[model samples]
Target chain A: MTTGVRRRMGVEERRQQLIGVALELFSRRSPDEVSIDEIASAAGISRPLVYHYFPGKLSLYEAALKRASDDLAARFVEPREGPLGARLLRVMGRFFDFVDEHGPGFSALMRGGPAVGSSTTNALIDAVRQAAYVQILSHLDVQDPPARLELVIRSWISLAESTALIWLDGRRIPRAELEKQLVHDFAALAAVSAAYDEEMGALLRRILKDEPADGPFADLVGRIVALAS
Target chain B: MTTGVRRRMGVEERRQQLIGVALELFSRRSPDEVSIDEIASAAGISRPLVYHYFPGKLSLYEAALKRASDDLAARFVEPREGPLGARLLRVMGRFFDFVDEHGPGFSALMRGGPAVGSSTTNALIDAVRQAAYVQILSHLDVQDPPARLELVIRSWISLAESTALIWLDGRRIPRAELEKQLVHDFAALAAVSAAYDEEMGALLRRILKDEPADGPFADLVGRIVALAS
Candidate 1:
């Protein structure tokens, strides 16, 4: 870890290092509070090197956010074959685990003010949510008016996101208990949605593919499908 | 308003004045950034007089929060005799309206940081949420397990809260569109849960309550009940 060792690295490796350090500092302090000079000093690099990596603080923030988004999406889209409910439960479990491990960074991402008018994060979140909806609709074997699926998908996403917020606030519910409750709760919602006509279900499945699934979402897709069907 | 009338007042009037000024300031800036002296200066009162009304900044913050919470709860819990869906929608609409009008204050209450700890604000928000759950549950016409009722109530609250957060971000979905989507979504979830077991159907009805014989939610609830049954 000596600063004296100046080793050259591949572009991808250097890019990842910058994101990792930026996320670390951003999690500990506000975006405005952390300066480019501090990042450069901490990384043992010259100011020009930092500038070459990111033109400005805003660009650096976006790049960090993109890494986080990509990481989350990758986890969510992992292949799983099983009943929608089972698969969804597994996915959600993974999501919660990730959040617990990376609580500070996740908090920074969520609680940071207004994404500076960048719709990138919101779009990414929405894409993941859509994936869960598609997984649920497909599992449930629903095919009907698109609106019904939209309703069901939105309902599930709301439940999952709210639950995660509560959990993050240090509620004392055990991990097992939380998982059981989520499954039960989601299953109940899915069952209700399944009664709607099939057209909405089909439309929802389409939206699912349009969005990349990742981050704090677990097997939400399958559970949603099970409930819708 | 006159800046320095210096009219002597009783304890109650003085206390009211302090709270009014504090809330005005807190709404405009973070609670941590605002100070007692600034509040006193704004209200045109002596520092000692402000202290006489409240012991310290934290206490004053709690008092202002309590006042806002009480007002919010009152608005959300008003009686509405209609179908379960319509009544629930009315409650949600009022909630969104309150958030829109009091964006800064409401955001402070909801997004308060770790520095704020768990203030009375949280308890107050929880109470209002519970009240909404009770109102929604009252319309249901079912005798089911307590756990099932809890599931429905939790899911509904989650949906309502999440929607409010998104709406607070200034995403401009029309009220009609939001309501329609919510009703359809909740209905689908209710139908799916009911199909899981007769008990779940009873739970869904109990949570949504029975719609008036000819009200808007009557057909929606009936259709859901039919699907689940």
Candidate 2:
């Protein structure tokens, strides 16, 4: 019934909107540099209005951190059907998209910089990493994977994150090329992991079946085989 | 020179002493949190004395960064007389020492946190990485390496950097295991690169001569051979 300058909004919508504004501001600067007044003005609302939604700046920041981490976790999810290579390419493509869209925010969220205030935000970021790890494991057809496979995958995830940060910070390579390279790196890491663990070795063989025999992955596999021989 | 409370310290010594104090402070807290007063008091000097050696906190911070890079570069230059694996283990051991000793300083320097101020500090950090790249290249016994070899080493270096940050940020694994794992990862990365580049492949074969059959490296090579078959 009310749709005017003083339009009514639900509590969740208002809270989410405030978080969106904070996230936008935070994406550009560290949390310390962002004042309550700046966040309010950026949101096109009064300062008190911002405080009304969130008691303090740190609370607002935590909300933004949640929003970003949730978005990143959602991006890692892709359909498990198709060649693993194709699926990985598509999933990595989405990851880069998030980086492109959330430039500074991406940096802030990933760095969780020295400016980070509390352990709550740190835990929130850790949850994001864990969630990504779980999603990566979901691709494998195992409920209880061996410890080494889990470690390798987790290490690969860290590699992916650092590589993305460098690519964004330096614009080192084209996004398409970077995506393919990361996928190749992941495959290579798995193959390398296979070098020491029977279970991981089997896992690589299982995954390789879902990949075609003639791309960067095939080239990598060919070289690995040549080295072995 | 007068030997009293106002004894004259050489320009270089005074500057270095100030940096020493700043580095200690920075190792414990992020740059934003460390005030000039704390830096001054920590060094047993006055605030003006700090300003005398450096223009501001940022300059002091930059100097500390330069010190870290120099010390780290020095660490990586182990005697080239030993077997490459032993040498790398030694070099990586120093790296881990830096990671352990520097702690938050290492995190701040590598993360280049969202609160990062000027590009000068960044350029200094980049120079450190470039120096590392050169040092790593030196160990390869190649004056002019192929692009792929360079990429693999560089990527490995990034992996090393991120792993250090994560290890410090969270005691994910014990330092000894993490060091061995990283060294293995570098060797594995090189092997993966070898799969794509014959020269790198040859390099791997050459290096394997120094490794014993009972070690992790041998196990990895065996698995790689198994994959090839």
Candidate 3:
């Protein structure tokens, strides 16, 4: 390849570049509002060149959504070293970081994508939820989570999604506070379930056993106890 | 009045009847799958007669959704006599009753309606959420809810919605348990918020002060305290 000769982009590189351009545009406005022409222009390529990479706008939208889903799922990952509460706080912080950066795209993803009854869109969304669920389970070090545990995990995931969605509407609440509150919400959800079931109680105790006094879970305990005073 | 002859339904009554029939059909299936003919046939009338009442299927669907929204909002209402937990449990029971009877319709409503960019549908759905929020605030007996209190209430409403939506998928969890669990989830969410904000903490204590020992809120406190032991 000649140096600085405007080297021709490889087929895969060009496709990735187009997806990046589309995703950036989509992050600003809903996918329905962003046109393929705008995407092509933003990429500094002709409309036909864009079409050459992807079949249609819907297809391109799905590709961009897939990329976002992966980015979101990765946000849920954290090292298993720290206490679970601190780990979750970090995870939530990163999770909101993505939301803060990609407000419209995150909203669209939570709303199940724009207008199309695409199974691909549904699967991508479900994949992100499942990824978060599995990561939480891994943190718990459980081989098989009981029904109530599963319920708590799944419900908390939904809470986080809705909380972020609502927060995106003007984001009236400070992002940092919401992030810390989400971590506490997870603990509260699990604690309530633990109050009901023996299995959940045991699970909650085990999880709380290793938590530091300054951790979110312990902070919740201290706050609840203070109420009794 | 002609004796022993079929009486024509008054226009208002007939319109209400058509909406009832359409809502029944939409409850069994999504609004998208139900048609104008079905509504007319269900009402023992002709298609033209159905069109005489409502201009089109979308209009009929909107009418039906309006009725369902009213019914759903009604489910959240409770007498303020009992402890808040018990009151909330009864409300959740009725709420799930609606979800149980109208699983598909509930799912569609939660998913923001089927295939149409109908602002009416959106408005009706939002009306239900707003009604639920207002009802919850009333149950708390707060004149001016603090920001954190508002967040807890809104987030809990969203949680209840998503929990029901997930449960409808397979009916895997027992409805009664889920109902009770939802009451616990609300207390848990509020308690966590209370831990952080003074306004929320005061509100939570006031609410819990009225709760009985056997009530869900106290049960949650007992469970969390047991873990500490």
Candidate 4:
């Protein structure tokens, strides 16, 4: 867009555009490395104009993080469809797509501890996690999960999070394999828990009954039985 | 243990005593909430004397963290005898023991991100994780792990770390159950990787062969198979 169009932008529109610019810059590098002048230039706006929207860099960073957190939470959304495994695999795809696209930004947000003692950043991280947990539970169609099931879901969420963070360190493993493996990991975690608890067992059986012979959950069983043979 | 005997302690002894005292206080409460006067009084020494050992609170906090990190690493040590599952369970027991005893301190160390912009604290955290990784690899008896195996190990490590941190929040679940579940998590994670890769499959076979039917690993397999039937 021309500078004329940029100047005529509405107040909220300009604020959002500035946040988008800051996020784009922050994604390429650590937020600490990006400055207000750089963000203003990237947005085709002046330094003073950037200040008009955000009081300072920390405010801008948090705003950017809030947006990123929302985006990350949205990635966990998947339509209820055929098999739980297939749906989960799609969810992981979108989740990792966010990770893959926002490598440095994601790392900085997850790793930097977000402004050192800033509860806001921690809350944002927790919000994303809580969102993912809720989304998965909704997919499971459970109103209130048993304790063991909760542990499995929370543990798997942690696994998926750390797996993505570590994967970004070098991208050593193929993106697709990690994605599928994560879905399998979820089933594996739940299966192990189900084996020990009656409620979890009932839950697993219910989930498995809905899974098809060629679905991801059944495929995990197939591989295990193959190993036994 | 008398104050008279404490006064007779040597320079190194006094320094060690100070660190120990600081750790004890830090363990019960966040480091920021604890002060030099508190540490000094806890150690039965003058505040200046406490400064004689540590340059400042930050230095003292780092020192206490160093000791905690070393102790944490030591918990991963296991005799090369029993089945891997039993050994892992024991390790998790000790790991959780540390988490249980140092509730606020562990939270501070793991969740607080240490000093703002302090690489020292981050490095200490990484060192603990690395130490755990090496110890587990030695237990697996693998000199050079395949990519998938590495992923499993690293992912499991992250899982255990996050599980413990989450558990410390309210600790609604029994500590003993979580300890056992973490070991099972390792097996579940590794088993899933084995299902997907030949090298990991062979590694699983090797591990299973050594595991008694009553071992945790075998118990996991039994659980999965039981779910299928």
- Identify the candidate with maximal lDDT: 4
Candidate ranking (lDDT, best to worst): 4, 3, 2, 1
> Which stretches of candidate 4 lie above 4 Å from their native place?
A1-4, A113-116, B1-12, B46-52, B113-117
**Model 4: residue A164 alpha-carbon error in angstroms:** 0.7
Quantify all predictions' global Cα lDDT against the true fold.
0.60, 0.74, 0.82, 0.85
The superposed Cα distance between candidate 2 and the true structure at residue B69, in angstroms, equals 1.2
Q: Evaluate model 4: give its lDDT.
A: 0.85
- What would the per-residue lDDT of candidate 1 be over residues B62-132, giving only the tens digit for each residue? 88777766777777664656566676677667776776666666655555432233435556667777766
Q: What would the per-residue lDDT of candidate 3 be over residues A63-154, giving only the tens digit for each residue? A: 98889889889888898897888898899889998888889977865654554346677667778989999999999998798777887888
Isolated chain B TM-score per model: 0.76, 0.89, 0.93, 0.92
Worst 10 residues of 1 chain A by lDDT: A215-224
Worst 10 residues of 4 chain B by lDDT: B109-118
Between 3 and 4, whose TM-score is larger?
4
What total of clashing residue pairs does each candidate reach?
41, 0, 0, 0
1 versus 3: better DockQ goes to: 3
Q: Highest DockQ among the candidates is held by which one? A: 4
2 against 3, candidate with superior TM-score: 3
Model 1 Cα shift for residue A223 (angstroms): 14
Give the alpha carbon lDDT tens digit for every residue of B39-75 in model 2.
9888887899789889988889888878877888888
**At residue B30, what lDDT does model 3 achieve?**
80
Residues A1-229 of candidate 4 have per-residue lDDT tens digits of: 5977877899999889889988889888878789899998998778998888899988888898899989989878888877888999998999899998788888877665447457677778888989989998998899987767777898899899889998998888898999999999999888877877888899889999999898888988889877755
Docking class of 2: incorrect
Per-residue lDDT value at B102 in model 4: 90
Cα RMSD to the true fold for all candidates = 9.6, 6.4, 3.4, 2.4
Which sections of candidate 2 miss by over 4 Å? A1-75, A82-86, A93-134, A140-155, A161-181, A190-225, B1-3, B197-199, B206-216, B223-229
Error of 3 at A138 (Å): 2.4
C-alpha-based local distance difference test score of model 2? 0.74
